[model samples]
Target: MMKSKSKILVLDDDPNIVEVIVTRLESMDFNVHGFTDPGKALDALRKDSYCVLVTDQKMPEMDGMVVLREAKKIDPDVEVIILTAYGSIEGAVRAIKEGAYDYISKPFEPLELVTKIEKAIEKRELKQRVRFLEQEVGDSIEYRIYAESPAMKRTLAIARQVSDSDSTVLIQGESGTGKELIARMIHYESRRKRRKFVVMDCGATPPSLIESELFGYVRGAFTGAIKDKRGIIEEADMGTLFLDEIGNISPEMQTRLLRVLESGEFRRVGELKPKQVDIRVLAATNADLEAKVEDGSFRPDLYYRLKVISIKLPSLRERKEDIPGLVQIFLSEFSRKTGKKIMGIDKRAMNMLFNHQWPGNVRELKNIIESAVVLCKGTTIGPDEILLSGIREQKEENLNTLESQEKNLVIQALKKANWVQKDAAAILGISRRVINYKIKKYNIRPEKVN
Candidate 1:
């Protein structure tokens, strides 16, 4: 087992320059490998992973552009910086079009060269971090199941175990449950990680274009077909395809999709010979697909085919135990993003979050946190920061029944305690448990107390 190092392969015909570059890069704490021959450099690239390739544009056998093109073929993500003479600026521009990161003109200051190298490396590191994070998020099969509930934990475990296989997946969940995230996770974790992951929202897109988009169309296939285009199935060949809200797709499109899944062969809009592709289908639905099949709205065979490995995401209310954690997570994330220094939510604000029936599920909770983060002023998020319309509307309706003086006193207590019953009880010189029973009887939301 060979250890990995941050190696930079320096390919320049000039021996003195290579030596100078190598010595400087080594001093900057980089592992340097120099090559005069372009052929040998290509071979080294194949044998090892180099963080960046610094090559002169004018070489003996192959030029820098040619080398860069070949290097990209080996590893498309490897950053390439071209060294061009002062006269070859036009050529450098063309090289950049072919995917060179940047070009340095000859007769440049040594400090300027070092600065360019530093910037290039920094950019590469940032790209690498984003890629790793995206992969981690995409690879986690349980991301859709955000709760820490035992049922969700078990569901995630099953998803992880089955992600390596090429089996079809059927994701069942209510509206706003993240069924699509689970499908993305399976695709990212599977053998087809490098290929395309296409998503088709069966309910959103019109039925007329669904078939063409899924299968693809050739030049002159229709009035708008000016060029040959690969269908989504072909685009997703050797990868995964996510069909969202599958129950809403038309019967014709469903039949076409079923045929492709069954035979791994389908024709383009105007093409005769059937094209074959290796694609994994991941289908999701908020509707009861089995009921739809029974009622003749969905195909029975397709339903069974997609349900080879089934998983369902639970609603947020059913997993109320995880609400505090979820709320804290959302607050931190939103605060950081919005540049707010909100330390934590007040006790009253916390009560309102937990007691409210989250009809919109986790998505609603996240939005609420984001909105609060935007409006919050100081370090701590107080009850006044929660501006939920439902809570405000209910509070306004109840305000008219009480005398102005009495209402003011109750509002003062609620606001002072930040909505927690025990704290409010202490302020009013009452027992904690009695305050709790009163909270229930009065239907007073913590955020609504003021």
Candidate 2:
């Protein structure tokens, strides 16, 4: 059985040109629709979904640029190619600036046209795949933790397996390693998903308020207690309670928390009656609880209770291979939020990203990408647009190296010249040929500007 071909729409004022394009596309296994009248071709576009559109620059009712605009309005993802005669090159360039996929000169070779079309289709497919990934992450009920590395995948698989049980989960990782995100994922995927998921940061709260904050308080329980109030634990009854930075709680609070975990019983401040509630606990910490236990800072019994099912998330450096995917997701997100048309990142910028040690982990990477998207003035991100002052400061010894210094100089020149290689060379007091050589040597590929 033969698979159906992708649909393509072709429009031109000359019937001969339209016939030639249609015949060539159809011979290459594309489902092609040809029309001499612009109105009819646009009508077809409005009625049917097409993978690509090939239109002539000049027409009676509409120009190719108008066709491109209308086609995009109908389907922003559709790839449009403009056909222009030799004298109408400017019009073709304008069409490209207005979002046409690519422009082909009239009297173009059949093979050349086919090759461009194939490339355009490939780009469209890539965009579709990125969109699918973004949708998958956005729609997930579990917290949005994007990862393509096997270590993180294995950790998530274990998380899914243990989510159905009421076992206390201890997520251990470095700061910004998304421990809190994992806690949320466990809560949403567990049986208590429908119930409230209350969060209490053990590290941020003061030692004096930890007890009263975890357990409810009665009127006159403390100087500020004017009325009865429920705490996070009571609010999380029949639900999940997430304790972030669990290693930071004092010894007394640990003992109290251990009792709650053991018997599901706790008493509000200034109250004698014991309150019982059914709740699951999820704890996370960037500190070494085992070391703390040995030092008598954290209780051994409490540590054991929290580690019933431990999950250790890999740091961003451990999963560097996932940076490209994460960058794409972040670029799309920031673009939509900021209303920027930033398409993608250049190869040189991506290499810099991969080389940097992300001490702040995924959180740091997301912030960097957001800043780049906001600062980027072109359709794509180049190395000059990426701001990594902290990372550079940490690697100050490497700054004096020839390659590093040269790379910095080249990035500065490119930024000042708006990425025009000729102008960038002039600004750097070098020949265009030398600049091109350095660009290739340093693997600096700036995004194309229309």
Candidate 3:
């Protein structure tokens, strides 16, 4: 039996031909509708959702071209197959040029007709599946992270655990470390998943307008304020508001934000009455808030409030083990988008990726892979195609400076304490735990280094 829920509309103008086609289709367990008049067939198409339309080329009221065009108007996706007794090249070409799926000769076998119908239905179903997959992948945030390293795993685990709460979360990480992506993951996995997730870049917005953007203004509150507007916080009511680069906001703005976090109430500009909302705030920053607080720039109280639940993200260099997996994800995405058959990266290219320090983190790696995929002509990506012109030199300089500073500190501490772990920890004014962590982090083998 045919597994499809498809109904075939057969319009041949002759009752005998229509009967034969309908009987054959029904024998194969297909739902078949027969029509003798082209006008009646077109009217039926408008009323019902038929999968395939088999219409005779020559008719009294209208030709196959008219039926095809009218049927397409009713359902653009409907597959229309033209049946012509003359089988003339001009007629076949015209039928096809006018949007007919395929032209079938009148003397064709029943099996041949069935084959064409089956192929047409399969094509439509394939297209529908592709659209669905695209939407699913586009909307999924889990696919965006694409992590394999333990550091990333730990970060994701923390995000998931805190998603159920409404407490303000502070995410501290370097630029392009997927801070926004993690913010989205938290929103999508939360109880308020169905609500809006609004993002505001505190650093990008001008100081003059940042307040108005967060707590909107009323009509005539200021120049160009013709109408009352809703701020991002209000828009994110019963949802999540992600404030990126939170450290860049002014001290006054920080105080305002503190009030909102404490009471969930804020008034629109020029409004006396306070408006209440149920919003979850997730703030991200790359700056050292402790240092900022000490310098009397960021409010210490606000900093403490924001850090109630803090998650520090590991940079790409710290989690280099995840690079191969991330590269694969980007390759698959770009290959699907560009209709390319790029299978994987060569060892030389992969090694180059692993060696390079990604200061911009995952975002930089993704951009590099995208550029390579676009420029590559072959199936696999090679080192020659991968461009790292300006980034490589800067990364090398930064890496050298960081390593030299770390090596000097470790060497000095070891020398001052005569290579004793406890003495070294005491001299550095750090705990034994921290000394061990740094030793591993910097790959400091003091005995072999000297």
Location of the lowest summed lDDT over 10 successive residues in candidate 1 = 388-397
lDDT of each: 0.74, 0.80, 0.80
The parts of candidate 3 lying over 4 Å away from their true place are 1-143, 388-450
Per-residue C-alpha lDDT of model 3 across residues 71-98, encoded as one tens digit per residue: 9887777899889886475787787887
- Candidate 1 positional error at 393, Å: 8.8
lDDT of 1 by residue, 1-450 (tens): 011235688899998888888888787777789989999898777644566888999988898989999999876767888989989999999998999888899876767766766676666666865775575465342363465788667777777888999999999876555677778777767876655677887766667888888888877889999856667787676668899888889888778888988989888888888877778999998788888998998899999998998998887767777777877887777777787788888888878877655545666566567667777888877677775312232344444632342334334446656665666555443356545655565666755653
TM-score of 2: 0.57
TM-score of each: 0.58, 0.57, 0.58
- Ten contiguous residues minimizing lDDT sum, candidate 2: 387-396
Please give the lDDT score for candidate 1. Answer: 0.74
Worst 10 residues of 3 by lDDT: 387-396
Each candidate: RMSD to true structure? 15.7, 24.5, 18.8
Per-residue lDDT for 263 in model 3?
93
* Distance from true location, Cα of 433 in model 3, Å: 42
